[model samples]
Target: MNSLPPLRQPCPPGTCTCRRDELLEEPGADLRILRLTRHEEQRLLERLENIRSLADLERLQQRMYEQLGIRLSVSPSHNEVRSMRGIVIDFVEQPGLCRKTRQAIPAAIRRGLERQPEIAYRLLDAHDLLRDA
Candidate 1:
């Protein structure tokens, strides 16, 4: 069983802020705080539409690194990382790949690759390159 102390919020003159932690602790609380503004949301949606495959993923990663300097990569699962890297390398060696073949890459990574193209791509590429022989 998980137990945490009740949260206490800073009090203003005759006013109290809700304890965010306590609220989050409640079962089935669906509270979400939006971190991005409207423009950011629109940009993210647009970027997501452009990602297609491993090359696109790479490009997106590079774009992110240049723009925001955040690095994204695959988890440290040996087999999955190796497989993804192979796909990326294959795409690199051969350009003008068919859309059907490109579709084989995972959609989640594709979307991520789109959102912050540069950084995510570099991190993923580096991870793929360094994890194995």
Candidate 2:
């Protein structure tokens, strides 16, 4: 007789065992969302290299606000903005690019935006950094 609780069936590797995991991992899981591109990744990595401290991150944050036309006072709790700021700071602090950047940055950026249009259209239209948005 089995003494322990019956083992649960293992989820298939390609199956959606966890909706949250699927949402987090799949790039094309949702079409309405704005995704981060390689150019933005490269740009962030390159620009972040110049930042060596929190002061630099703060300056960059200001620049992002000015350049991206983001008003923190208006959008006091914007995640997309904060995500971008964090990405730059995290990238700079590390010696090299994090392997998880491609997946992580876009997700973070999406989280930070108050609306899909903010990233899907407006920011892309305003900023020249993105190769194609």
Which one wins on TM-score? 1
Off by over 4 Å in 2: 1-35, 61-99, 102-133
> How close is each model in CA RMSD to the real structure?
16.2, 17.6
**Please, what is the TM-score per model?**
0.31, 0.25
State the C-alpha lDDT per candidate: 0.42, 0.37
Residue 71, model 2: lDDT of 22
* lDDT tens readout by residue for model 1, 1-133: 9974332222343332334345456776423321223354346446645656556655765764354332344433444544333223222311122233234333545455545556454655666745556
lDDT score for residue 56 of model 2: 47
lDDT of 2 by residue, 1-133 (tens): 8674222232345542223343446664431111223455457545544444434434655664454322222111223334333222222221122235533543444444423333333443343434444
lDDT of 1 at 18: 34
